[model samples]
Target: MKSIFRLLFFVIGLSLVNAQEIATTDATTPDGVGFKSKNEFYIFGDAVVIGNNILSKDDKKAFNVLQVNNDDTKMRYVDIDRDPTTFSSSQAALKLPSDFKKIVYAGLYWSATYAYEKGSRKQQKGNYVYKGSGARSKIVNQIKFSLPNQEYQDITGEVIYDGLGSPTHLINSPYVCYADVTKLLKEAEVKSGAYTVANIKATQGYLSGGSAGGWMMYVVYQSPTDNPKYISTYHGFALVNKEEPLDITFENFKSVEKGDVKTSVVVSVLEGDSDLRGDEFAIIKQRDGSFQSLSNGARFQQNFFNSSITNNSIKNRDRLPNSENTFGFDIAKLDIPNYNNTIINNSTSETTLRLKTEADRFYLYFTAFQTEIEQTYFDDIIQDNNPNASVTAYVSPEIVRAQPESDPSYNTKEKRKAYKYTKRSLNSKAFKYLKNKKSAAIAGIEGGYYVISGVFSESLRADKWTTKLIENGLDANAFINPKNNWNYIYLLRSDTAEEAFELTEELKTNYRYRDTWVLKANLD
Candidate 1:
């Protein structure tokens, strides 16, 4: 029976709440978490970095960093125009706050177009051109500081920059050059009153006579709090197939800032063969310090039902076997206050954690943040099998996303949606005339049990997933049962039990829903 359960688990993966106001594509999972499309890390709330909303094209969109390299000051609130030769006198800087706010990351957005002005070879009249080298290579730009008058350094390290294609080949290319200047900002003292921020002012020696070329620095700041929580996921768990342990490194993830306290650690294990005691995972402080067990109040793992696979177990038989195991627990046993907890330490928080596998292989996920600081997905926007969100230069608190229907086709998927939605001003006369313009189907949903993908406890999450399914042209619904405390996110419903069962089987085998099951309850 257990083997049957394992097989089912292997064939079908686990799931979670798909909240409304979401999108297609994977959210920016920190480099550590192996789990993609499941977890995320972002600021708790929204913030404005450099509200540059000054462009006729794509004007409504907010940009923390804007480069008026086209020599158009109308495109930015604080435009820094300069030629390469005037570096000494043509530098620009923004003063930031010295309070709890910290610059998490920074980037330079690249954008340039050819002007009617003559070039050396030809008089290109209004033709478009690209910035940076033609190839997908690194272009280093100078950024200086004003607080202590420090020296300039070339921004380098694990940065993700997008590539805009050649001038003629690409129509829409939103590319950014990423850089992290956290260490430099942390050590620099704010000038007498303001944050002596970055110097993102420079130019190409050849952008002469109105030929556009400029640079903008996108600054990301995190406002500190009395209690800051952090959540993170790790990748590369599949690389280890045997019963070997993997190190959970914190160096790459910016979870722990200065002056933090040790909090709880939740270790999630997916597709494993065995159960885990809360003690299997340990937090090792420093390189040689003692290992601390965080399993204070451990919740034993719960086994979910897999209908695709059946076994000889009397209660559940005749179906395909389900063999997958999923479990997670909080570190409740360790005396966090007694020792210097690396996860909660005020200085140099947890460097690494050790996770031992129960069997041959499994995927591990964890989020460790200090008090009040919790982990979350970026604005509830996630993607599965979709293009990734482009790397934007400026960092905001979180993203604002619309929910997806069951099919979850991208907004770009024109065929899936019935109509195209365009943003219009509230004051527009057409909006008033078309305010009541909404279309409805000729018929309503049929009655019967719903063959659902997953049941969620959160109504918001259930509704979110339902929207995605609906957008995909599926008859998805989020049925709530207050008495049973169930929120079923169903894909399709039928009038008869036999039909529902057949549909469930079809979904399991044909629709990639190996664990799809039927759900029925009283409407009243």
Candidate 2:
């Protein structure tokens, strides 16, 4: 079986192109095909049977043809093997397409059929054989045919008929499948039209079983009109769990973390122009509980998929005397991965490959910074009220950690070197969502705080102090950059110089850690 694994793999790959039509035997079809009800009027296709074969006495590999719906109200059967009538299309009681230039695989499942008896005197009677219309043809109806092979040629092509015995014409015998019908159907051109930036357009409707995911966003428009359906539009580019289009904004922006849910987490970026058939890629679920393509917008750019976040909590230390509090961010960070370069034709526009953000630098009109004061300090008041109360506190903090910065200086010629070091330090495996949204200049980055520790008598306390600072409300994740020996801890959600100073003052007043300093905002 392992030797034939490649063959099986190819078959499975071909199956995906037609996911909607092919149902597993365990499942009932949407049209109620598996029901026992009589009025359902089941339809079936023709079968492929081997008749007069020289190799085997009884060919077991034969199949039937597809039967028509509402065409004939009768049923019949024909032995694929040794049945001269089966191979003769001239007197084929039923008619196939005249220009029937091709037959890929016979659609066995969708075809209709009836039953017949075997090895009885009545079987030899005309009632045993299936007749298309009239006569004593016993109508043991047969439907559906399995594909023969991968070869493809016009049904009108010439072939040498076997001359071992009497002359015979293998007319409709699928014994030779010279036409690659699978490829034709998959790459079939169903629709062709374009629209403006936000215009809604509809091509042909897609397969309903969530199989035709690539076409879902375009097909499932609310009104199906040319109007820009903002809210009703099913955008497949945001978090995958909830179906909603993220209004493009650029205020209060931080950084996009990888694995922050939109669809399947991007596992790996494959080499070369995007291969639509790549096994690594999956579906991008849309707002309407549907899915669409998440292929990257530009070439040589990273494509992103849905990402996951393990720990949303990042912290910084308290600098005030007799205090050990931690701070965190209001917004949670999810994970996302970089995409491999996608492929598109000359007519298609490039894709935008940045993460969603809300800031002035990343998004011109929008701001990503979100801020609010801690009106009721729960930890502060909780301990004062109930000295020994075993209570769980909501670990909400003021500063959320963004993807760590390597070098705040973005202009130096050495910046490229800095990025190389930075990419490696972040482990280059975690998710970042803000990266993609920043490219369009419509997202924002929020403000957060990091922690710095003062000199302590014990080495463990120095580390422990920083951890405790994060526990209260700080983005004090240790960003040990190799170049600067200075331990720069950042904080989230500070808007101005005064606000940063106030935070620093509070830190100094609360925890007695040594020299705490603030880094100036680099946003221009």
Candidate 3:
């Protein structure tokens, strides 16, 4: 099944390279999907709104469509960056926790409603008339990005969905694209700072549906103090409405059986009204498989997809202009564990998500789910507290020494007996012994002595250290010592204690591994 998926992705990649568009049958379905799982936390932010306003419940009845003649309602560029050279640029701040040690992944997504400006807009018989035809552009996937204290650089991404030529989007065509920016963020001097995105293509006139354009950045980071989690990101394009509610199913992840399970979801949508109600987000309950509506204090259960960017119940006001209503862009993170614990408990390894609206229509482009899972540990060996203690302490000197000086010529039989006695004495010292086990049988660890190079309390740090060792031409492996729950990274393994001891001394000669030590397992 894994090979089949890989082949499918390969074919999809080839097609994308040729056509540069993710083909979809209609405007209300996903053309492609991408997923990833890791032990990390994710944060996202977006910008590029021309106007901002506080939409009241009463205002929902006044506006039949989002495109109005007012200056605040018009679709234009939100040039908050104040860079005179760029055409359409906006800035958004990414404020990650200081404790987030490393960035695991970063993705940049941009979307827009395009192709409505080529038509003539006029009034006929007290009704607005639009004669424009939907069109696609070749440069829709090209964009410019700027990091803090840096200049703009060109970037091109894979087009996830392009709806310009689709039959459903005749006047208000929309498209979404994404780029993997993990390498760029990792190379940056600082991960959290103001980010600017420019050259996003979108209609800037009064089209049929409300004109909208923006760019978003999703970042996943690792912290040593954070719990082990299964983080999965999925991307697609679809429309959810009253007639056809979208249901997305998530699987292939395990959850912890004990303790408070932490799970959260992040979603990005377009064309959702801030004043409108009845747009609901629901997830199937693990207890009885019932769909429970999800909402926070700022978002009502009936209006879950209102235009805003939020983390939990807190509205993120760290962007330029900090618009109260983002016109139509919505990026939010909902805490599932805080909403209800009984629905998504320890038994939940799979669940389905449903999104529907009674009076509003919107497009869903991206969604991500993260949940706490059982932490995995290496089962290579049991940890001994006093690893440096003398092995001869357990064996009496008389038993290990030659039988007697009187036994001339050092009888080989007596020597063999003493060696056997010493081995038996060591076995009785609270140590487990095994023999002739294959390397695969013990978590890819053979029965041998290990030369440990580093020890860490966190698995993520241990993994990082092991990677650095491998990059430096050393075959490194890591395992958790169950006794103390500490991670131990080993550089070499040997079949004999003397060989392992000699290797440790040789490694200690290097300044990097000056504190290297040896661990011996009683494997016959």
Candidate 4:
């Protein structure tokens, strides 16, 4: 009787232990703790499968199913059995059947949180966050990859620009823009290794270890609107920083004077290790008339190539395009306390500056990982398969301004006396129709809109007295040396000159621009 009782107790205790282990395991495993990382560094989210039927009508009539074997049927068949693995690269994408309609986008969620510990100046021991055993430490600079293809990869790093604090910046990875829903889901799935399943199953995973570790998982969903080109679909857990304010000064983007408009200034630090020179550091000037040290941040290691210099005509300076420099150094961040501005000792404030000339130029704080980007079909594939179908792609931004020209002749018969003040009356009429026409857009050689500078020249004496008007604050060069072929014009993008003339009657100051032949500027 004693032996029998002992055996029964032993069986019950083992069963209880087994049940406890199974309860804590992920959905996919009865006793397994989590999915293993394919590469040495990181684990991926579970793979998800999603597809929708594409139905096509024979004609555009109310009810037309006249032909059973038409273009619509062929399109539906093509969409039914698409191989997600085919569109695995950064730019790889698949096409949706044109005859078929209705796309269902599906994704997966693979979330796991862990304790995060960050090194700090105040604590010699360092600060730490407590998390459950399954939690993962945050990863700042790490590599991320998609399944089935090994050639394509991205480095994930933190971007702390705009004084918005810090957010994940996945730089240097190839980006994709596609309209197909099936292609996006395929790129967002995990599809390699031992714990593979025939169909995607819900699973709990543990992701821990790193400076700012936490749990994470893969999540998938469909977009309500038709995904436009140049847009991206992304999902992941990350830290959100405070929003940074922007101040627009005419010094670069516009022609307005400093202190003319009250705006919040902020600096956006670009992440990368490109060649930077001492002159680039001078770009940021403090109020006390001191320059920030050029070698203040971490020394970056370059993995790419040699250095080359070119004259950046757009910014009116010679600089490296691929190199890293202070990108957005707005004045607003300086005004705020406990933000970007810092008071050193008793007299000066120090602010770290950052920049990127081109989109590819990134500053080096940590390794940049292309965690995820929009997935799309390759340009050649989309064009070959469907000639009429258009694939949206991301393009670079270009500056559109008046091209420089040769010096104006200024050799009129009476160089100094042409279009002399003809008792002109600078009144409300000078800016009569202009107040309502404050803004206008023009056709650009590049893809985006180009705002034309307003040209104000007396139609009768356009060529004459243009120099005098230019001295009084008009872009004489734009009219004199235009890429579109025009000489002897006075242009203004702001209301400064026009406003000055309109108020001439009230002040009677400046000796009378009213008599100086004023006319509304016609912007082209």
Number of the top TM-score candidate: 3
Q: lDDT tens string, model 2, 1-524?
A: 00000000000110011112211122222111111100000001111111111111112232112121111112112123243424211000112322222222211010011111111111345434322221212211221112222222222211111111212211101111011223432243321121001000101111111000000001110111111111100011111111222222111111112222111111111011111111112222222323233333221112222111011122101101100110000111122222321221111111111232111001000001111111121112211111221122111111111111232222333332222111111222211211111111111223332223332324364467578777876666443323212233455335444454455545644323312433322233
Mark the regions of model 1 whose C-alpha exceeds 4 Å error after superposition: 1-48, 51-148, 157-175, 191-524
Stretches of model 3 off by over 4 angstroms after superposition:
1-72, 118-123, 131-136, 337-340, 377-524
Better of 2 and 3 by TM-score: 3
TM-score of each prediction:
0.25, 0.16, 0.65, 0.17
Residue range 1-524, candidate 3, lDDT tens digits: 01001001110100011112222222343322332221122111111211121121122122223332221254556665556665567667787764454555677888877775433467799887766644546578998888777889899998877786677665567788888877898899976778888777776645665666667887765543223455556566676767767776665445666767777888888777677778999888877878889988868899887777777887777766566566777888877853346877774667778888898678887777767654321011112222222121110001111122223223433342221211222233222321222222123356678787876767787888889999999889877655346576888778865556566666755545644655654463
Model 3 clashing residue pairs (backbone): none
Candidate 4: RMSD to truth: 28.9
Top-lDDT candidate index: 3
Query: What lDDT score is found at residue 43 in candidate 1?
Result: 41
TM-score of 2: 0.16
Report the Cα RMSD per candidate: 27.5, 28.2, 15.7, 28.9
- In model 3, where is the ten-residue run with the lowest total lDDT? 6-15
